[model samples]
Target chain A: MSHPTSTTNKTLAHPLNAWYVAGWDYELTRKPLARTIANRPLALFRTEDGRPVALADACWHRLAPLSMGKTLGRDEIQCPYHGITYNSAGRCTSMPAQETINPSATVPSFPIVDRYRFAWVWLGDPEKADPALIPDMHQMSSPEWAGDGETIYAPCNYQLVLDNLMDLTHEEFVHASSIGQEELSASDFKVTHDDRTVTVARWMFDIEAPPFWLKNMRDKFPGFEGRVDRWQIIHFEAPSTIRIDVGVAKAGTGAADGDRSQGVNGYVMNTISPETDKTCHYFWAFMRNYCLDSQLITTQLRNGVHGVFGEDEAMLKAQQEAIDANPDYEFYSLNIDAGGMWVRRLIERMLEAEGRLAATQEPQPARVGA
Target chain B: MAANSSTVWQRGRVVELRDVARDIRRVVIEPESPVRAAPGTHVDIAVVVNGEQDVRSYSVVESDDDGTRLALSVFRTPTSRGGSVFMHGLGEGAEVELTQPLQNFPLRVGAARYIILAGGIGVTAVLGMARVLARLGADYRFVYAGRSREAMAYLDELIDEHGDRIEVHVDAEGTPLDVPSLVGGLGRDTELYMCGPIRLMDAVRRAWQDFGLDLPNLRYETFGNSGWFDPEEFVVRIPRLGLETVVPKDRSMLEALEAAGADPMFDCRKGECGLCEVEVLELTGDIDHRDVFYSQRQQEASAKMCCCVSRVVTPAATGSRERKPVISIELS
Candidate 1:
């Protein structure tokens, strides 16, 4: 199979017509919050009625960032530079100094919805926005699961982060002190895909528990001295949602089958939204089914995952810097990049299809003589 | 009568087909060209059934903006005449004709709250509405009912996606829907939309009226050719074509015209698309407005009617009546 060389290019465009996590629900308050996605600045906040809204951060008049402004009434955002107040739909509602406000005076508003404790924004045509495409991360909010989440700004390209998550072999060397184990790199794995999703699954039979798992599972299972069944299932939902299901169970407990109750199950939701060419917003949560009400386990898992991500951040940032220094060099893909490569191909196909549509939809030029 | 002049037909290829439920097949198609469709809209698919071109409407389960792909979940009922069976018999890579998405049962955004009622395969019609409402952060509840869990399409997916917001009632499971209680418990300023079998819709309509809810807020769309009046044979006169045809109780006006060799441009025989509409020059009886395409005022005026679904009803035969309702119309 032939691979597109452009996939390795650093200037690849991010797919826009898809839902991306802007921030957690708790992060947005009455105050405007600024975030950059796909190199576009966005101002996000909730109205008095608790409806989340996102708009272009730049004012339509003087190009001042709206995140620096204050909210007026129940749903209008007032620009600090000119006192131009806009409603939740991004239409300019009032202008303090002008006698007649221009009807065209408005900023681009994005389609936003709150679900699973996260505010998701559609950075595409509002008319075509469909919430069904949003990845199912309900486990984070379900009563049967307990977990904590965190958002970190990584100084690296979003694709680098995706690549890192898609291939967990690095964990053996990078996260050896915590959740890493040799079985992760040594075990055989399989890659599968449907029309809209890609999954990478790996199972290590009768393997020793890693440090983090041992620390958490020792209390739950006191007789956990022998080998156990461990599995890692990573799912990539287009365009940029990654969920990793990692857990272990007693030897020969049928955990590999549909019976997950025989094992301890936890989910790692890693949602990547591009901030710019060299930065991204990483919203992540760790949910476990075994300890639904244990605050201690939640905190421990949160800190442990946070530290593990920090190690990835350091490595990715350094990698980005090196790639920047050698801008003309093209990166090569390995056998383990199958999952990440599939995601890249899907994004490219969508982008190409959109481009073709726009080309055809462009107004035809009038006949020269007619 | 002249055929509908505004219908735009496009070619689509069936790419995938899988049974999601006992008799429900999730059909995914790739159109010849990309077409954009909003949530709560449907497209008319044209299939050759028994050596004749037949058109039927199916709700769009999902579609992208570029329209590169469209997905529809269709259920084959035992009472189905031929449309559902013809669609089910289609294999992968079979190219068929379809019209652009048409919106007859549109979701009215900005309501204080939304209540969606879906019965059996009718869930396909309101599934997109729920998705859009969820994305808008609007308060909404989805109540879906069917004979059994095994016969319901998208039940598992809907529950997985919407969680507590969805309430599923399976009759075989002893969970029957309480229409009165459900309608009575609705909050003020809420709008209710339903799409289902005639019985379910009629029950909801009656309960809604009993509860004193705003009649305009209770919107609905029927499956196919379903109406309150029992099917009866009638005669249609086309002044321009100088043709008169007898529409049998089992056939629609459009079908009768086609059988009489009078071409009628039409799409979405389900009565959603305004194509195949005809101007009513004279009417000798009351009209049964089965189609949801026309407003109440338009239906009352009796000026025009969608030939695909709407029909005329003569005054009840009284004192040995032998003549049927005669509707003189011209193709619009």
Candidate 2:
């Protein structure tokens, strides 16, 4: 018999208290862009002075979408249905029907911060919104790091994408031709977590570089060829952000000991924002410490990561479909799920703090015979 | 969804066992796999109580960064439902069934300032969290209270590690905790995380409300075994299951039902989760609710009870002395 209860559901509710990236800094311009985060629709735009702002997408008058309307003076947006105009704070400044605006004729203006080349919006209580709580994605804006990235409209829950990045063993099966190597599953990893972060670090010694790493190595050192030491250190910050530090060094270098002078290092920056229960807006970038001035290398690496992540997109879509089909079945986890489990636990805590947790228990590791 | 992998009960060996306080035992368990435990992590042990296997949860006191080893201290409650008694009897090399480290009371990072309060045995649940905040160089204070100095576990160790950041209060020393002043003095940005006896938690809760502090800023973990009234033997009759059993003072209603072959759904087993709640069709005695899951209004209604930790307490002189307190429930 199948039993469906709140405690066994696979889909998790999002935490509104945390910050989720709405779009790239360039995407939010004078024109308003409609985006949803944590199930709340927001109209994102920039002020004339180049400061980002996020307001409720629904107009206070007649509930018309404000994003469909055009910008008026400075930072004001006009309602598409009527001529009502709202300022950056979502307060109605002009009403065509009357001289005096209604005191309650105001939409919610969320607190937004433009940092690390992304516009992050807080969809919860404005009083508790703190910019310091934004996940650290320093590589995106650092002058020492150079790269570019794109957005993936993933057809899966944000947690699925988080699980995919927390464990890289699946790369051996999903992206075998690009970054996969048999040594990945064979290597032992150490998983550590604090209140807000979970880290999984793995290193492979004296192994042949995967095709993706080999190509990147040759870009920095034209004729680089040899067995190399590879490392994948994944750091996950609460809600939905993961930054992976990856690279390969010459076999005998002391890369594992914090000396990576003879290595080519790159960081895969990812922050996913939930648009709804079954969809997410995935913003990612591929940044590298080396080749800071090489536009050719930057474009190549971006495209390379794009191709690699496409495979994950397909797999995650299929996984979500399977989950929907078998709503009575719960996911089973293995040793590889240690990091992902911590990520889920952290998100669960956030949801509980927001009074949204409904007894949903993420699957634990499979039971072994006693 | 069906219950699949909420927990993986595995066999673990009691590698070390020692007395940490006057009535507390510190146990070290070595599982087959490494368990990386963060702050507020706990483990569920399948202990044999009343000759039947039952699950009990205890907060982790300490753990290695690599999770190769885990330590927990259990208070030898004189009024326990036998979980603590079974734990106190465990010797080195004993095999026990245990779940991996599970966290429900996670410490939210990035708070402006933190104040961690522990009352008596509640210290076990908040010790790791205080340590993490201290290590991060964050602004925090640790307030620990016990009935006496000798009964406090890890008192010297905590003082040595945290130094001036630690504050000690002993009721026997006439330094009882002042919840009203503590709650009233909290700053607007301070987050208070506490774990302790129900009365202590209740006092803090009432004081926090009176001061009109942010509700979300006050987080706590319930000592599941502690409640408002002393446990008494009662009769639980489930009509649909056609089961009737006597819940002894040393056992919980959920344990009694499971022992009678009536499987009941439960998670956390600490009464925080409402999965094990059953509708109360009728009652012949007052319900001693020990769960934080329900609100004051809901508990006052007496329409439902959490089977994991709640029970009925009959008046001493009501009806015949031989007649036990009975509660009829509807279980789906």
Clashes of each: 2, 1
lDDT digits (tens) for residues A98-212 of candidate 1: 3334444678888788999999988876645667778888887898888998998999878788888888888999998987888888888899987668899999988888877
Provide the lowest-lDDT 10-residue window in model 1 chain A: A356-365
Model 1, position A254, has a per-residue lDDT of 86
| Candidate 2 runs further than 4 Å off | A1-9, A359-370, B1-332
Q: Residue pairs in steric clash, candidate 1?
A: B3-B265, B4-B265
**Each prediction's interface RMSD?**
13.6, 16.1
Clashing pairs in 2: A4-B1
The Cα RMSD of model 2 versus the native structure comes to 16.7
Q: How far off is residue A157 in model 2, in Å?
A: 0.6
Root-mean-square deviation (CA) per prediction: 15.5, 16.7
DockQ by candidate, in order: 0.03, 0.01
